[model samples]
Target: MFFSCKPAEMANLMEDEVFMAFTTYAAIVILKMMLMAPLTAYYRITRGSYANEEDVSRKSAEEKKKLLKAHPDVERARRCHQNDLENVIPFMLIGLLYALTGPELSAALLHFRLFAGCRIFHTISYITVLPQPSRGLSWILGMLVTFSMAYRVLSTVLLL
Candidate 1:
């Protein structure tokens, strides 16, 4: 019996891509999961109904904001969480789509890294009250990643 190694092609799977896909998923999941910390802090600080009738009855977000007014840290945490949801959802979906096509290993790493690192740094900056442009730069990094992935997926390089 004999076996032969095949060249890199559509049928071939690169370890970098495969590992990045798995790690990207893990990192995304962790980022999402970590939001709970701020949420818990908000709930504790605000002392609002996190799981009780206040949640169901307070359909008006304005009401919730009013409740959290006394706790600026909590309010900031909530806003940061909202921002994360706004940006991360699209990025996560786009990242997953790109992962399936298995882009160039280096490109994949850069995109994944920028996307994850930007989000992480953005959250840190938001929580730490960093000056202007710090958060914006991180956001742009993540957006650039998504844009790059979108372009690659749409480009002639990979029809998938």
Candidate 2:
């Protein structure tokens, strides 16, 4: 007995890997969006404001001071959330590069998942009660993913 492979089948298999990577990226993005909800709620509840810039500016200095003084945890969460958003573009670029460069799709997918998980954990630790080490560890893990991806892309570009 012998086995035979078709050209169309091989092509389809190759396409699956890229599709899988894209789907994984999309899933992580959705999770990131979901994670923002709790952060937003905490901000709204403690800061008494939403994403409206005008509304935030309308608050008196006394009120702003009172909000910060009243809920330090919320302030911390807001700051952390903003930092996370700042890094999101780089993270997405890393994933996209990996997909484009035909790296180990599984590794890229795992990195994306790890980053998303670490971010959620970091947010929870920030918004709720948690030890410093635990929160710090989560933050570090998230940063590691971002940096690792950036390094991968840079190395690829430089080596060419």
Candidate 3:
């Protein structure tokens, strides 16, 4: 019975590790949101509203007629938020898997680091509007890391 519980305990530890990683990721996400808040505020101030997409599009058109320059910072903020939305799911999945199947601590750490690095690179590349290849590569790396964690979890389940 003790032996049987070992894996469960390890799995729990791994889950904790993953949770910590996710907490770090969440902090960065929050930072990104905070960074964008000012831009959003500016957009609202200049445009008289905070609605996005079709609403912003219509407002922007009307504002242009009135000779107000589009808020470039607000646009940047929108893009940053969009990028976060795109990558967050994969990060969460990987973290969850890590928690459930604590793989080698070093390997898991490496994967987490790589994923976080790639996310940062991806965001920078996006903000700078890097070449398609560079941005694509970063995104691919992030996905690969996430998939690796998932595979590890699935294999652990299979072994059980």
lDDT of 1: 0.66
Model 3 C-alpha lDDT versus the unseen true structure: 0.66
lDDT of 3 by residue, 29-144 (tens): 54654565575666556755544454456456667444444555556557766776677666675566565565665786777777778877776776667888987898899888
Summed over model 1, clashes come to: 0
Per-model C-alpha lDDT, please?
A: 0.66, 0.67, 0.66
> Where is model 2 more than 4 Å wrong at Cα?
1-19, 30-38, 41-43, 46-70
lDDT of 1 by residue, 1-160 (tens): 0123366543443454554564665477466647757665665545653434454464577766655434555656667777777777777766666766656777777777777778888877887889989998998887888888777656624435
Q: How close is candidate 3 to the true structure, as a TM-score?
A: 0.63
Model 1, C-alpha of 31: deviation from truth (Å): 3.5
Q: Which pairs of residues collide in candidate 2?
A: none
Each prediction's TM-score versus the true structure? 0.66, 0.64, 0.63
Q: Who wins the TM-score comparison?
A: 1
User: Per-candidate RMSD vs. true structure?
Assistant: 7.1, 7.3, 5.8
lDDT of 2 by residue, 4-41 (tens): 33787656645767547656765665566557769667
Tell me, by lDDT, which candidate is best: 2
